[model samples]
Target: MSQKITWKDKLDFILFGWIINWAFPQYYRPKYHYTRYRKILLINVIPQKILGINRFVKWPVHFTSVIHSPEKITKGILCDPGDNPGIYIQANNGIIFGNNVGIGTGTKIISANHNKEEHSKHDTTSPIIIGNDVFIYANSVVLPGVKIGDNVVIGAGSIVTKDIPANSVAVGNPCKVIKHNPPHREKFTREEFNKNIPKQYHHYFDISSHE
Candidate 1:
C-alpha cells in the first residue's frame, strides 16, 4: 500500500512554493528584481563557513559601479569579483572573464567610449575579454575593445589601450609588455613547484624538470 500524504507534507509543499515565488517574482510581475541580494548572500555568507571571511568582500561596492548591462558581465571560478574603491564596468556590450582572474581594487574597465568630436554621442561600444590566470593590479584602466589574453599580469596604475598577448607582464601609464614570460613561473623548478604548492594543487604542475 502507498503511504498517505500527511499535513506536514502539504505544509512543506506550500513553503517550497512560497520560497520560489519570493525569490523569483519576475516570472509573474514586470518589476525590477532583487536578484543581486541572493548573489551577495551566496558570495558573502556561504564562503565564510570554509574561508572564515567573505569571498567577494567588495561585492557591495562592485554592484553599485556596474552602470549598464550588468547581467552581461561574466566572471570565472576562484575570482575576487570586485574592487575596494570600486571598479566601473560599463558593460554596454559585454565583459567576459576567464578562470582564476583577480581584479584588484580601483580598476576600471570601460566597454564604451564617447565620440571625440561630438562629446554628447558615443563613439563605439565593444566587449572586454580577460583570459584565464590573469591578474590586473590596482588603479588600472582597461579601455573599450581591449582583449587581455591568458596568464597575463598587469601592473598597478597602468592604462591598457590595446590588446595584450598571453603570458606577458605589462606595466606603465599606457601598458607595455616588459617581459615575454612572467618571472614568477620561470624561476621555479618542478620539484620546487610541487614542494611549494599545496598537496591539493600538486596535480596541476608537471613533475619534469623542464616546464
Candidate 2:
C-alpha cells in the first residue's frame, strides 16, 4: 500500500512546497510522477529559488548548468535538458532532443557558431538534432548542426562536428564512430528499469510513492 499523506506533509505543501511549485510552474503538472514532483520541490526549486541560481529558467535543471535561449530548445517527456551540473547548452539556433536522451556532466551542446567573416555575429544554420536513447557522456562538446541518430553513445571528452549514424558508439577529439551496435528496441519492465538506475537517484522514480 502507498504511504498516506500526513497532516505534516499537507502543512509542508501548504507553507513551502506550493510556493516553490507556483514559482517553478513546469513540474507542477499532473503528468510528473508524484515522487519526482516532491523531489523537484525539495531539491531543485526551493534551493535554486533561494540562491537565485537559474532563477530565469522554469524547469528542474541543476543550478550549476548554463543555458541560453531555453525557448529554442525542444524536449520530450522525462527529458531533463541541462539538468546535470556543469552542463552548458546554447540553443540560439535550436536543439531538438528525442525521448530518453542523456547529457552527461560538463557536456556542452551549442547550436550556433560564430560567423567567420564577422566574429561578433552568430551563424544560425540548423538545430542540433539528437535522437531517442542517445547518451553523450561527460566533458563532450557537440557543435552546431550535428544530427546524432538514435541509440548513439558518445564517449567522454569528445568533440562532435558531424552527423553520427544510428546505433553507433563514437569517441575522441573529433568524435567518430568506433563501433556499430544493434538497435535498442528491447523494452524493460519497471523492475528491470529500476535496476539500471543508481540507488542514490532511486527517489526520483519511486513507484511506491505514486498517489
Candidate whose TM-score is highest: 2
Give the least accurate 10-residue stretch of model 1, judged by summed lDDT: 25-34
Residue 159 in candidate 2, Cα distance off native in Å:
0.6
lDDT of 2 by residue, 105-199 (tens): 99999999889999998997889999877899999999999999878999999999999998899999899999996666533223422113334
Report the backbone clash tally of model 2.
Answer: 0
Q: Give candidate 2's error at residue 160 in angstroms.
A: 0.5
Candidate 1, residue 24: how far the Cα is off, in Å: 14
Worst 10 residues of 2 by lDDT: 186-195
Colliding residue pairs in candidate 2: none
In angstroms, the error of model 2 at 61 is: 1.1
Question: Global lDDT of each model?
Answer: 0.59, 0.73
The candidate scoring highest on lDDT is 2
Q: What is the C-alpha RMSD of each candidate to the true structure, in Å?
A: 14.4, 8.3
For model 1, the superposed segments whose C-alpha errors exceed 4 Å read 1-67, 117-120, 182-211
Off by over 4 Å in 2: 1-39, 47-52, 185-211
